[model samples]
Target: MGAHGAPRGRAARPAGEDSRGAAPAGRDGYFDLLRAVALVRVVAYHTFGWAWAGLVFPSMGVMFGLAGTLMARSLRRPALTVIRGRLRRLLPPFWLWGFFVVTAMLLHGWMPDWRIVYWIVPLGDPPGSAWAGQAWEIVWYLRTYLWFVLLSPALLRLFRRAPLPVLALSLVPVAVLTSVPPPEGRFGGALTDLATFLFCWLLGFAHHDGVLGRLRPLAVVLPSLAALALGGWYALTHQARYGGTYDLDDNPLGQAFWSAGFVTLLMYAKEYAGAVGPVRSRLVTVFNARAVTVYLWHELALILAVPLTDRFWEVPAFERYLPLESQWFLFGVGWVLIAGFVLACGWVEDVAARRKPALLPGGRAARMGT
Candidate 1:
């Protein structure tokens, strides 16, 4: 039996130990579940309205926290090795998806509409005054991810020597500079969004430093839950006053608090819930194994699903019309298309990984399957 009394295959450790040769047994299943949940939350939050908005931002923070923890362990490598590893893992898949989207536009005869989306979709500027179109909204995450990887070395070094309070306080300037007042549109300002990235990454660093294990779940959960409840209420109450926009500062604070609570809850889930059933575990494992592929292909999946389904069923004209029922339907349709792309386009990334494993953290290839 695995740690949870389930089979041992659920959370597969990396093919080998980390670069520093540490044992991989310390892996956390809850973190895997959390990543899976966070990816879903992102899709759902944007797709299903704000029903779970309280969870999504914090979940991302949890992911960043986890990433930071891992980074903390790897900062000692030579600069070339670090840069190479990160680029190999992050870029190949990104480039493949970019090509796919660009091709789709050409085939659909929508090349002219590409001008605005071209920017935001490729981690460049958002369209003129308006936000980029739906086909490419997910790029925001990718754009931020690129920035994080670029700064990982410096961030890792700074946190390695600094006191916890010093590192934590170091983020204040970033938070303040980013937290300008809310904009007119529901769109979040770019400056404030940085706070979310820093907050999550720092949390990850702390997690690596054994911070969560120091606090009981209850201690972490209570205040976080309260923040989400009250903070959300406050945002909604004043959201309209800000011209339908949600404040990024308000959003990140709520998300950070909530993320801490969820991370604690996940730790408990592993200790208590045990195996999540074999079939479910296997399914989640497959999805998680190809996580980067899934994330990279999801946007393309959405774009492709629209046209094929459009022949028979029409997508809702407005974003609001997409409810749970509609989302589930879309989810079903999306899986079929994305699965095929994973087999084909995803292979492109695997090839690059094999050729230059050292480009990823600790010189590891992203595993495609068990």
Candidate 2:
């Protein structure tokens, strides 16, 4: 069933229902609102742009935490079983969306045929790399998610045992790796350094075991706040220092702080912020119901919107628009059209879910890290 307690259709229910007769692990309106907020941030940050790109980490941390909550819940079953079920639900929409992105790019002459392979393998240049322009930029998250899913079993087991120590240790790599400058001629400069996501995901797993509640509120709250404040400051300063552009991997301090804030927020959401109602409740019901579809098609909408904005609206090339200073009206209008296109393709995800290939009893991908 979905968050509203309705059974989802093929286009809808890939996330599966919680045993509590609602969305898996049941619904948390705060999280739904958070997801909505995060999606909006992504839209704004990408469309209109923001100087403090560090702010994006908070949303990412929350999203990763959400993924962990879902992952922890699935741990009741054998790791392989959980893996198979998740892949069955996840991969089809990804494959569909990828095909759609490639088709749109080709139709629009965005690139040549050989370029489509990068999207398929999900191994293109990072956002700043030469080949980065050739790949579907927004879809990079999917590549990371696929890696996370592939590694879920080991990650889940580690969290299940020695949860706190595990979470603590995971952060060491994030600090070390994220702080280092990206190597030349590489696209995945930040992938290794951002270990906080793994830590946050594991923290969610432990929360399922009541680990967070055992700690005092101040213990969690103060550190998270400090992280956010300090990180935000660093981000702003760094932008000013670098003439206003932040390399994705440049803000380890901010990412660390944001991840901490995410954990604090999740704790609050689980305890005091239960069951928000009416408008949020309904919006969650709709979005969670169709999340897979929406995610799959969102990039296609972006790609299609690019041409229309250029051809009809006479907007400048996407990269030329200054994010921090762009007029909200022009950006908002383009986003509205893009959002509509995404909504229209929502049904296609349902079709893909129903037609996914079957997995063997235990065989899933052999640890293909994103």
Candidate 3:
């Protein structure tokens, strides 16, 4: 699955539906909307480098929670089958994106070694040319997500045996890391990310198992609000330690608690149980379908946008008429390029999903062969 995109499968019926008269199994529009918003927030955060954006949405945690819910749903089948299906959906789009990135790095005089193989599986942070910039940072999310998927079978079993206790215990690793000096380098970074989001991931299991739904309204709301408060308080007071900002990304414990609280409430509500209306449904479908492509290519698009926008300054008419220097203009250009990549490369997701390829998903043309 993409960092911000969950694996898609038929969701379990919502809480109130009677099985006999239940509507057919279908997409959860609420979950789909969360993902679409996460992807958009990711692109916007990367483009604008906004600190408060993390507070506003906390995209990574939400994505992990959603992925965990879907992963639990899929584990109804054989474990090996579920894992294989996930890898199949995830890797092809990555390989296609890697082809261009790795080739670019090599052309820029990047020396290859055994570490280059990480690009193939990305079990670790993949090496890239410095010239490639922060584009490669997105791989951390993929690496973390892959770890979650692989461990989920065992995690789910343990979660089911004792839902509340295991869910509470999930916070231990992050708590320990936050108290002590974290380890240095790639392993530490990966461990921090895994630990940080582990709570949210298990919260997904809680949501799936009806644990949250079974709880009283106050039980769910009070602790969640308290968490949100503590996380906000910590971030506010501890800003100077983290580059003089309260960006959740800089504070693992804050992010973990905040995201856990925020995502839990969203998942619990199960709002918009049916389709999120017509036009929004189509947009959600496109976002979920091409999620991998959007995430992998978005940074590169933003990188390319800078030079492309710079070129516009040379044309007097464009420089005067356009907000050429504004980050908003760059954001717009980035999405335009993202749309181009989706048309050019997004079909790999369809192929991976065993659906007929389409330039854009959820359209009449894509519907033709299905």
lDDT of each: 0.53, 0.54, 0.82
On lDDT, the leading prediction is 3
Highest TM-score against the true fold, candidate? 3
**TM-score to native of every candidate shown:** 0.68, 0.70, 0.90
Candidate 3, residues 259-338: lDDT per residue as tens digits? 98898778766621223322347888899888899999999999999999999999999989999989999999999999
Ranking by TM-score: 3, 2, 1
Better candidate by TM-score, 1 or 2: 2
Runs of candidate 3 exceeding 4 Å displacement? 1-24, 271-280, 363-370
Misplaced by over 4 Å in model 2 are 1-25, 53-57, 104-118, 121-135, 179-190, 193-196, 240-243, 246-253, 272-280, 292-326, 352-370
Q: Using lDDT as the measure, what is the rank order of every candidate, best first?
A: 3, 2, 1
What would the per-residue lDDT of candidate 1 be over residues 260-285, giving only the tens digit for each residue? 44554554344334333222354455
lDDT of 3 at 348: 96
* Clash pairs detected, candidate 2: 11-350, 18-23, 18-24, 48-323, 126-187
Per-residue C-alpha lDDT of model 2 across residues 1-370, encoded as one tens digit per residue: 2353222231222332222233333355555666666666655555545645435546667666777767776666677777666666666656666675556555665555454555545444222233324335555565566567668788877765776688767777666654674454434443653354776677667555545544445655676677667656665667754556553334655565566665665654453323343333554444554565555455444445566545544546554654423356445655666456445655444454453332211122111011
Native-structure RMSD, model 2: 9.9
